[model samples]
Target: MKFTLAKPRIFFKVSRFLFPFIIVMGVLCFGTGLYTALVTSPPDYQQGDAMRIMYIHVPASWMALCVYSLLAILSLFILVWRHPLAEILAISAAPIGALFTLLSLVTGSLWGKPMWGTYWVWDARLTSVLVLLFLYVGYWALYKAYAHPAQGIRAASLLALIGAINLPIIKGSVNWWNTLHQPASITKLSTPSIHPSMLFPLGLMTAAYGFYFLLLLILRARTEFNKRKCLVQENFS
Candidate 1:
């Protein structure tokens, strides 16, 4: 009981401390990443200037999967410990994850057109990623379907847990099945396949996106907490 009630106070304090720092870092990282990606990064030997589209697509894809994994962990916290803060966090993060998922899909299509001569294919990786996007959408829709807040959160959390099985499949789909989508380049068993010139901007963009997600998560959680706080005050009064 003490632990559960203590959570919002703790999270609010942490959010206050970290919010400004992350906002500044996110802005700087994106500034550098954008400049480096568009200008300094060399054109691909095969795909030429068209490969530049990757800077946005790759980072967005990475964040999409990562955010869902985070949702799964939060689901565990809510289910196992019944943490109110965890419930707020999961709800706060769903829309952001869904946005990234959509960005990844759209960017992937843009990259695919020139390289694959088609905007999309029924490749394993692509199909699995689409499913992941649906999972995010489903969670968002299901959570809003209930008038009772607690019941909605429980249902959505359960869906998040069940959908997590798709994460590994999305990661491995290229390797497991012959697909037009390229195998892991920046992430592999050893050193990254991409050159340092491309890698640097890619790294910056990734950091920017990660911190941007953190900023959103903290702000959203705080807002949700404050709204609930207001509700409780009204109920008691």
Candidate 2:
């Protein structure tokens, strides 16, 4: 598996075979999750129907953090191990991470309007998450700003590593501060605070998001690899 991932051609070939399975599973999870989140799961006694937004908001927030963590690791590979595929994967994933961060913010605002009586707040958690979005955008912009791809990737990867400081802040903000955002219900060391009835759909939606991110990452990495191959050929020709 390590050998396969190190070689772009091998990785691309393996991903091609796995792509259809990812699509099928993602669709099934999304279909069933929407059914349960929108139809079956009981609404919060307090927040009412608006709480359904948690299905999207919570999972998107998770993925946004997960992807950036992945980016930070890939950056280490690019900077230290100098892995060839790491750069491609890093660039491919940055935009997807940004999209997930953006989705989380938008859905959280929509949910907040009814629950908090406002669409936006400068709470610690919200502000940290917003900083996360800016980090994602900054990494992407830094990658594109250079004339050489290698230079750009190294600069962007450094940014990714530095930005990792915010992940813990985002995760711990609710705990550390008197914030509007509720403390984590599902990720506690003890048993999750959430009810099993709602947890099922949240799990399903999280799986859906994971599969979708994998699908997009593989596709984008292949495209990046091919573009680099073409450039190399042109230089040699």
lDDT (0 to 1) per candidate = 0.93, 0.94
Task: Encode model 1's per-residue lDDT on 1-237: one tens digit a residue.
Answer: 467434788878877888899999999999999999999899999999999889999999999999999999999889888888899999999999999999999999988888899999999999999999999999988988999788898899999999999999999998898998989996788898899999999999999999999999998988898888898999899
**What are the root-mean-square deviations of the candidates from the true structure over C-alphas?**
1.6, 1.5
Worst 10 residues of 1 by lDDT: 1-10
Shift of residue 60 alpha carbon in model 2, Å = 0.1
- Backbone clashes in model 2: 0
Worst 10 residues of 2 by lDDT: 1-10
lDDT of 2 at 222: 88
Which candidate has the highest TM-score of all? 2
Our model 2 lands, by Cα RMSD against the true structure, at: 1.5
After TM-score superposition, the amount by which residue 189's alpha carbon in candidate 2 deviates from its true location, in angstroms, is 1.2
At residue 102, candidate 1 shows an lDDT of 97
lDDT (tens digit, per residue) of candidate 2 on 70-153: 999999999997889888899999999999999999999988887889999999999999999999999989999999988999
